[model samples]
Target: MQKELNLCWNFGCFYSWSKTLGCNLTMQVQRLESGDFDLRNRQLQFSTFQIINVVRRESIEIGYWTAKQGIFRNLNQDVSAHTYLHPMPDLNPVVWPGQTHIVPKGWQIPTNGKKLQVGVRTSGYPEFMKVERDPVTNAITATGYALDVFEEAIKKLPYAVPYEYVSFDTLGVNYGSYNDFVYQVPLGVYDAAIGDITIRHNRTSYADFTLPYTESGIAMIVPVKDNTNKNTWIFLKPLTGDLWFASIAFLIYTGIVIWLLERRIRNAELTGSFFHQLGTAISFSFFADRERVDGILARLVVAVWVFVLLIITSSYTANLSSMLTVQKLQPTETDVHELLKRGEHVGNGGSSSYVRELLEQLGFERSKIRAYTNPDDFADALDKGSKNGGIAAAIHEVPYIKLFLAKHCKGYTMVGPIYKSEGFGFAFPKRSPLVDDFSRAILKITEADAIIQIEKKWIGDEHACKNDETIISPSSLNFKSFSGLFLVTGVASTSALLITLVMFLYKNKHKMGINIGHDHVQRGHGTELETERIQESTADSNILHRMIQMTTPASKR
Candidate 1:
């Protein structure tokens, strides 16, 4: 009977354990409760009440259910009586050696012995049974079994499980001064994760970032004017000293050469004294006067030398003056405020930052600051003068102003210095995620040398000088023009040199009388023929006759 009771208790414990572990164990209990036993013309009802009572006493009591009172009582009494009559000695509760009662396989009971172990041999055993105690909190935690299983299961989850939550308050305390301070939020800060919150410029840093959002550099504010007509004097200032020195040297050299030539000519004419003049006049009177060849040659030589010197000096001075004039016209200033303070009306583009900085920071009156949409219109306004018909100063980027000045306006000049000194970049909305990505893309392009190549393709570096204050030389503009002039000059000089060389060679050949070519000479006639015949007869005579004729001296004859 005790053994039978133990079996019923084990069944009940397994049923309860399986239910807790998310397994179905109720069917087996129901079968046992409903099974009919036929014996000796007497019917006995097997009630589940006796089994449940035994389970509750030996194991942890989960809960109880009250059935129809008489049914369970009558069933329990019948089972007790039957067990007593059979008195099965082997039915005594078979407890493990150290345990007071048998526990279901694969389960662990606490050391207090208040509960029964169930499902001891099942796969859920060690996992569900393990427990750990926290030293800090003295809290008992289920460290093994289902807890471990849960951890492993979590690892296999498709998404990250948020194991921890961070709070910004833990990082630092908020100070009162930050309440009213103007915050400059980086456009990137709005998209970045700050403890899982996105913030704008004015938003609190609670789970929000304080990253710097602005790209900062130096900003110069200058007046907007027609900077195209750069003053020629400003450009020439640096080269004035050199030009002056060259001009002085040329004048002095030219004066000296002219004086020397004049003196030489005078002295040569004076060299022929009255006696020589009288002799020349008497000879001219007696016979057609021979041309004064020597005097004429000397005069021609002096005249050619003086003419060459004067031509060289005049050409040098003209070229030097042109160069100096060009050097004097470079753009020097683009500042608007300074121009306005000096009583000059300044013009600016309506949308340019130059206008804003001038009025706001520079304290210029709005009426004094004239804004224009079209640059040409602005230039016209400046040319016609302000509303009062007075000359207005225009300011703009050196390059743009220079181009305008070169093409359209000539009266206006760029004044003061350039205000801003940085390259322009495309502006975008702040806190955009695209900022970092685009910046990186720009960097990549720069690294690949694409930016320089693009610049060369469009606004070439040759035009970069337009942004500077230097005046562009006309020669630089029309390369072919300069080249053509140079070619013409070279050809003319070459022809002149070749002609002079030929003339010199002819003169030297005549003076030296060198026989350069072979030609036959004709014999003379008349008396010349008679003389030639006599000479020939004498030559034919004997050597003693010719010697006797040569020995007959004039004194002896």
Candidate 2:
């Protein structure tokens, strides 16, 4: 069969082939002889090459060789022998021809010397990670505690590994959340992600996380209410129940001692009805300078008791005054279980959807949960409260809540249970060796107190919650606080009673006859004379006589 040959025309060219194969043709074409070159009589020449049964398209090269050039001429020996190409037919149908993307293991420093593309969250959590863009130049600046830690960690590496931050918003119009941002690492969109991105179990399926650098837990924040107006028994709050009982008991004891001492001295004012005597005794204890004491022991007891009373009263007054004047800020709500049971609406901020899931897990109805994107939204929602179309409380991670409280520290406070979490961490592709390095670096920085300095730099000491709800509420005075005073008063009262008894017995020894085993004659006469003398003295003293007469009513007289 004479199949037509594929021919080409050239200004001056020729070819010679020694052998040819059918269907798959392999030919050796040689260059023209030296004498074949004619410059003046230039004419077009043509050459032919043929292959039978051309079933598939492929690349084949047809080139002329000269004696001066010595190089590999075998067609099958070199793949580059054929520069011009053809499409090869599919020989294996089982294999997929589409290319699958290869994710690089970013644990190693890139050999290409390109900066690692680190993705950062753009909105919310400004204390941990903030992304700012210049209005005119569109330049991005990533800062805050998270960024500071990340840069410091990079410096700890043995080899220099450069990185740049690319900002994205989880609450953007695209409705992306923090989980989506973390997935970017495995998708080869980012080499790493840093921010207040919490390390969670579900996210580990797509990416890996380094050890947590900050405190881990979700907390609730609510507006603080000034309870100074709401507390009705504020006066009673200054002293505990035990303290009150102890004080009253001491007051009564001191008064009884004073009245008994005055009665022993025949101070007729102490002589009255049972009820009248009780009233007289109480007045002597509390009402200062109400009555005068004659006995030295009574005076000493009263002086010590009075000192105790002065200290107790002063402390109570000072504490009560403080409670009444200072702003007693307290969280509007403190229990998460109560919030769940009441079905009160709660709000959450930032791009973390896990918070909603967590609320649901904690027995909160999904409909009762509201999501907020920014701090302002969170504040506004909390201020409105559940009854008024706002959330009753705002739930968020501790770091974010702290930042919020720092800014809104005046009327807001953190409360409720802190749900445990992994805290904030940097993310990378799965099994990234860089995870260990960064985790170790984090441990070092934390141990060295570098993280604290970084935290202070970004969050600042001034931004901390100054008016903590727990600290703002004044504690009541307990019995332990006044135990020393109670001891001193009790000792004085006991000693004065013993001394007074001793003095009375000594004064009456003459009437009783102190001689052992000897009975004195005229004991009755002696007692009678002593009694008469006492009556004569009582009647002679104008102060004693008037006191007795005034105490005695007209009907009694």
> Model 1, range 101-161, lDDT digits (tens) per residue?
5443432222233221111111111222233445796544443222322333224333222
Candidate 1: worst-modelled 10 consecutive residues by lDDT? 116-125
Runs in model 1 with CA error above 4 Å? 1-338, 350-355, 358-366, 372-384, 387-417, 426-440, 444-557
What are the per-model numbers of colliding residue pairs?
33, 0
Each candidate structure's TM-score, on Cα atoms with residue i matched to residue i, is 0.28, 0.63
RMSD in angstroms between candidate 1 and the native structure over all alpha carbons: 27.4
**Candidate 2 global TM-score:** 0.63
Segments in model 2 whose C-alpha atoms lie over 4 Å from true places: 1-145, 162-177, 180-191, 202-208, 230-233, 287-291, 429-431, 443-461, 464-471, 501-510, 514-557
lDDT of 2: 0.71
